[model samples]
Target: MKIYKYILIGFLIVTTIFVSNHGGNVSYALFYLAIILPIISVIYTLYVYQHFRIYQMIDHKTIVKGELVPYRFTVSNEYFITYRSIQLKFYDDKSQVVGGDTTVEYTLLPGESIEKKTNLRCNYRGEYEVGIKMVVITDFLRLISITFPIQSKYRVMVLPRVLNLSRLRILPLEKDAKRTLTCNNPEQIEMDNELRNYVYGDSLKRIHWKASAKKQTMQTRKMTQNPRQEMNLYIDLCKLDVTGMDQIIIEDKMIEAELAIVKYCQKMGVPINVFYQQDGPQKRRILNAMDFNKLYQESPKIKFNQKVSVHELLSKNVINMGKCLVLVHKLEDALCIQLQRLKQNRAELVLLYFTSELEEEEKVKIGTLRSIGIYVREILREEELVNIL
Candidate 1:
C-alpha cells in the first residue's frame, strides 16, 4: 500500500511538471485526472464503509468455558459497485474463532455476500464481548484505507468448567467420611446441665419443657460447644499484578479448581464451607448437591478484584482442628506464615497455588510450607487438577 501511494504521488508530480512545461489539452487533462484520482479513491472508500454490511451470529449467548460454540458471520455488498480489499479483525483476547484466521480478507461483487462458518471458544470464565471487533476497508487504488470499528459487538457469558473427580487424593476420604458422619449425628449432641432462658430465635426442639414448667418460664437446653470440624475452603479473590490474558488464565483456573473441589466434596458426602471476599467476607456451606449447583451457577459472576486477600480473610476467621484448603494465585510471606500457624494449630492445610511457572523464590516458599506438613500443590494448568487433587 505504501508503494502504491508513493507511485501515485510521483505520477501526480510528473503530471504537474508536464502541464507547466507544455501547453496542450492532453497535458491539462492528464494533470486534472491525476488530481481527481485520489479524490475519487477517498470517496470510494467512504462509500464502501457506509454500504458494507456485516452480520454475526452465535448459537448461544451463554456457553461453558473451553466449549466449542457454532459461530458464523456474513459480509455483503448491497450496492451495484463492487467492494474490494475488505478485511475483518476478531476479538482474540478472551475468546477465539476456531480453525479460522484472525484477520480475514474478502472482495464482494454487487449483491454478493460471503459467510464464514466456524466454532468459537472462550478461554476464560466471565462476561465479555467477542466476534468481529473492527472492519478494514481499502479502495481499489490501495491509496486510501479506512478502519471502521464495529458499533454493535457480540457478547457472551462463559461459565467455568467443572471437573468430576473419581476421588480426592489430597484428603483421606474414608477416614474423613467416618469422622464426618460421627460428628454430624444428631444423637451425639451433648446437652449441658445448665439451662438458659429460651431466646426468640431458638429452635423449638432445643426447648426443655420440664425445666421451663418448673421455672415458670421458657427454657432452652444449652448445647456443649463442638470444635470446628467441617472442611474450610478459601478462594483467593485479590487481583493479581498481571493483566490481559495472563489474569484471565489465573482467575479462570482458580475458579475451576474451586468448583471441581466443591463438586467432589458433594459427591463424597463431605460438607465444605467455602470462604471468599466479594463485597466483604462471603461464605457458603455446601452440604448437598443443590448447594453445589447454586455455587456453580454463580461462578461466572465471581470477580477477583476484591480488596481483601485470602490471607487477611483467614486471619479474621478462627482456624481450628479441620481440613483447610486454600486456593491462591500468588504466594506471599504473610500468607505462608499464616498457613504455618494453621498447621501448628493442628489444622490440616492443603494449598493449591495456581501459577504458570514457579520461580526459585516460590519454589522455596512452597517447600517451606510442605516441610511444615502443609500439603502444597502447584497447579500449572487446569488439566492437572484431576491428578493433583
Candidate 2:
C-alpha cells in the first residue's frame, strides 16, 4: 500500500512539473492521464467495496484443546469491476492459524467468487471468536487500496482435552476405610419429597421452582439418598498465592487433572459426583452419560475467585461426605485440617495436588497429609498422571 501511494505521488509531481515547464499537447495529455488514472482507481475501489461480500464458516463450533478446526471463507464480487491485489486479513494473536498465510491474497474477477479453507488450532480452553479482521481491496493499477471492515463473526468454544488414562489406577482405600464407606446404612432407594430452601449442594433438577416463586426464594426438593457411597470429587480452583503466568499454568493443570479423573471414572463405570467451587460458593453436579456437553460448558467457568482455600470450600458442604477425591491447585493449613476431619468422619479420601514446582515446605505438607489416612499424590505433569492418580 505504501509503495503504490509513493509511486502515484511521484508520477503526479513529475507530470505536473513537465507540463508546467514545457507547455505542449503531449505533456498536457500525459498530465491529464496521470491525474485521471488515480480518480478512476479510487472510483473503482469504492464500487468494488460496495459490491464485495465476505462469508465465514467453521466446521465445528466446539472443539477440544490441541484439536485442529477447519475454517472456510468465501469472497464474492457482485459487480462488473474486476478486483486484483486483494488480501483477506484475519490474524489475531490469541489463536494460531495453520496451513496458510495469515493474510490470504488472491484475485477475483467480475461476478466471480473464491473460497479458502484453513485449520485453526486453539491452545487455550475458553470461548473465542473467529472472524475476518479486515479486507484489503486494491484497484487494477494498484494505486489505491481500500480496507473494508467485516461485521460477520463466528464463535468457537475450545474445551479442555481429556487425557487417555486407560492404564491409570486410582489408589485403593484401606480395609477399614473401605468398610466405613460400605457401612453407611442409608437406604438404596428412598424418596424424601421434602421441599426446602435452595442450598449450595442441592441438585438443580430437584429445584422446586413453583414453590420458590411463591415464597420469593429459591427452593429445592430433598430426594431419596443412596446408601452406597459414590466417589465425591471436589475441585478447588481458588488462587490466592500464585499470580500472573504462574497462576494461569496452575489453573490449566488443575483442569487437566480434574477432567482426567472425571473421564477415568466415567470410563470405568464408577458412580461419581462432582462438587466444585464457583464464584466463592459450592456447587454440585452428578456426572452421567448425558452430561458431557454440560461439563464442557461449565468447565471454562472454573476460575480463580476470592482468597478461598480448599478447606473453606469443603466446610460449606451440605450433603453427607462420602469417599472424597479432592483436586486442588494450592494447599493451606485450613484445608489439611478439613481433610483430617473428613477422615475422622470415616470418609475414604484421596487428594491430588497439581503444581509445577514443589517447595520444601510444600513437600513436608504433602508428607504430613500422607501420614494420615488420606491417599495423597502430587501431579506435576500429564505423563505422571497415570502412576500418581
Candidate 3:
C-alpha cells in the first residue's frame, strides 16, 4: 500500500509539472484528484475513530492468583465510513493476558460490532486494572494512523491461593482458672447496657439509639465481659521492595500459611481474632469459621507501600495472653524482640516464617525465636504448607 501511494503521488507531481509546462486540462484534473484523495482518507480515518464505541466486561471480579479470568472486549463502529485497520490495545504491569496478545485487530464496516474474548492471569495478590488502554485506527491507503487513549477502567482483585492442609496441630496455653459465665451469649446481651464508641466489627443491631441521639454520634452497647480466650492471627503487611519473582512467591507463601492456620483453628471451633494493616493503624476483626469469607474478601485490599509493621502490631498490648499464630513474610530483629515479650505474658506463640531462600543470619534468628519457647517453622516450598501451620 505504501509503494502504491508513493507511486500515485509521484505521478501527480509529474502531471502538475506537465500541466504547468504544456497547459493540458487532463493533467491538471488528475493532479487535483490525487491531492484530494489523501485528504479524504485522513478525514475518513479520523471520523471512524470519533464514532467508535468500546465496552469491556469480565467474568469474575475476584479470582485467585493462579486462576484464569475471562474478559470480553466489544468494539463497534457507528459512522458511515468503514474501518480498514482497527486495533484494540490494552496492557497492565500487574497482569498478563493468557494468550500473550494485548492487541486485537479487526475490520469493521459501517454499523458493525465485534466482540473479542481473552483470558488474563496475575501472579501477585492485589487489585489489578483490566480495560481498554488505547485504540489504533488507520486508513486503507496506509497514509497515516491515529491512536486514541481510552480512560475506561475496570478493577479485579487477585486473591492469594491457600493450601488445603490435613493433620494440623495447634498447642494452646494452659486453661485459665476462671471461666466465662453460661449466660454470656452475645445475642442475649441487653440492648440498654453501657454505651461506647462504635467499632468496625461491632454489630449494628447493638447500636444505642438513645445515646446516639443525645451525643450526636453512633455508639454500640458494650459487653460486660469476653470470657472465651480468642485465638489470634497476626499477618505482617509491611512494605517491601518486591522486585524479583522470588519475593512474590514468598508473599504468596506467607498468605497461604496464614490461611492454613485459620482453617485449622476454624475446624477446631475456636474464636479467632485477625490483625493486619494497610497504610493506617492496624485493623482488627473477631470472627469464627462461619465468617471465613470475610477474611478471604478483605485480604486483597492491602495496598503496597503501607507503613504498618509486624513489630508495631505485636508490641501493642491488644492480644490476650493466649494462643496466637504469627504469619510473617520477613523476619526482623525487632519482630524477634516482640516475640520474646509474648513468652513473658504466658501467651503461646507459633511463628510461620516464609522465605524464598534462607540465609545463615535468618536461620540464627529463627533459632533465637525458638529459644524463647516460640514454636517456629520455615515455609520455603508449597508442600511445606501442609505441616508448617
Candidate 4:
C-alpha cells in the first residue's frame, strides 16, 4: 500500500482547514477535518482489499497437446461497485516472460463473481503449470495499491503433436490382412490398477489421474491387457553399419523404417507390440488400435529413450510377435544367422534389411530368412517404400 498518498491528503486537508478557520471565521474546523481523514482512509483501504482479491480456477487437471483446454478466473469485490482498471495476469510452464504483460480489465459487484475464460494452444510438449502469477488492483484517484501471490499455479500435461501420414508407403511387408484384435477381447488380462510412474512416450489415454493427483508424481498407468495378437517391428539398426556422417540422417532412416513397420501392421488391421532396448530387457508396450498419427511420432522417441538392438529384441520376444517382420540397417552375418534360426525353429517371420550404406544387403537377409519358411523382403531405396505392393 502507498502510504504517501494518505499522508499527502491528510497534510493538504489539515493545512486548508486550519488556514481558513484561523484567518477568517470557522472555529476548530481543522480538528473536525483531522477526525474525518483517518476514517475515510481506513474505510477505503478495507474496501479495496475486499473488492480486488482475485481467485483463478483451472478446469483441466492435465491435458494432452493439440487439444483445446479451458480455464476460468473469478474476480470478487466487497461492495456493489464496478471496478474499472483492475487487470489480470497470465503465465505458463514454458515461461517466455518477454511480453509487456497481458491483462484483462473488468467490473464486479459486491459478493459478485466475474468469470473469464481463454483457450491455450499446444505449442511445445511437456508438463506445464499455468495460472495467474500476480494481479494488480488500483484506485481511480491514484491513491492505493496491492500485490497478489507469487505463484498462482495449476498443473497441466502437454503431449507431442502427431500428424497423420499413413497414406505414405514404406508400410509393413505383409501378404494377407491379419485380424487378431477385438476390443476388450479375452486375449487381454487385467494387470495392475495402481500406476507406477509416467514414461515420456506413454499414451495419453493410459494416464491415471486420480493416482497422479494423490501421489503428486507422474505415475505409470497400468491397465488390463487386451487380447491383441502381438506383431513384431524390428527396426534394422545394424550395429556394424557404415556412414555416420550425420546422426540426424541415421535417426531419420531408423524412424522411417519403424514407421513402415507400424503402418504395415496398422494397415493389416492387426494389433502391434512395440519394443526398444532400454536400461534393462527390451521394454515391451502394446499399441492397440492407436491413431495412425500418434504411432508415427512415437516410433522415433523410443530410440531417444533407449538404445534398442534388433537381435536382442528378437532373441527375447520373437515368439510373441506371431509372424514377425524385421527391418535391418545392414546385412550382417550375425543378423542373417538369427533370422535363419528363427525360421528353422518354426518362428515363421519376414526380414527386410535396408542399407543406406549397401542397397544390395536389403534383399540378402530377406532371401536368407525366407529360405527357412520366414517370408522376408528388402526395402533398399527410399523409392521402393512408396511402391504399391
Give the number of the best model, judged by TM-score.
Answer: 1
In the range 306-380, model 2's lDDT, one tens digit per residue, is 456667767765246866788887778888888888877777778888777778998988898888868887866
Off by over 4 Å in 3: 1-42, 68-70, 96-104, 117-124, 169-229, 244-253, 279-287, 318-320, 344-346, 355-357, 371-373, 379-389
Best by lDDT: 1
Whole-model Cα lDDT of every candidate shown, in order: 0.85, 0.72, 0.71, 0.55
lDDT of 4 by residue, 249-312 (tens): 4444455555555655565455565555545554333444455565544443444334556776
Clashes of each: 0, 0, 0, 13
Candidate 1, backbone clash total: 0
Per-candidate RMSD, Å: 7.7, 12.9, 12.8, 19.9
Candidate 1: residue 120 lDDT (0-100): 96
TM values, all candidates: 0.82, 0.66, 0.66, 0.39
Window of ten residues with lowest summed lDDT in model 1: 179-188
- C-alpha lDDT of candidate 1 relative to the true structure: 0.85
Instruction: Give the range where candidate 2 is weakest over 10 consecutive residues by summed lDDT.
Output: 178-187
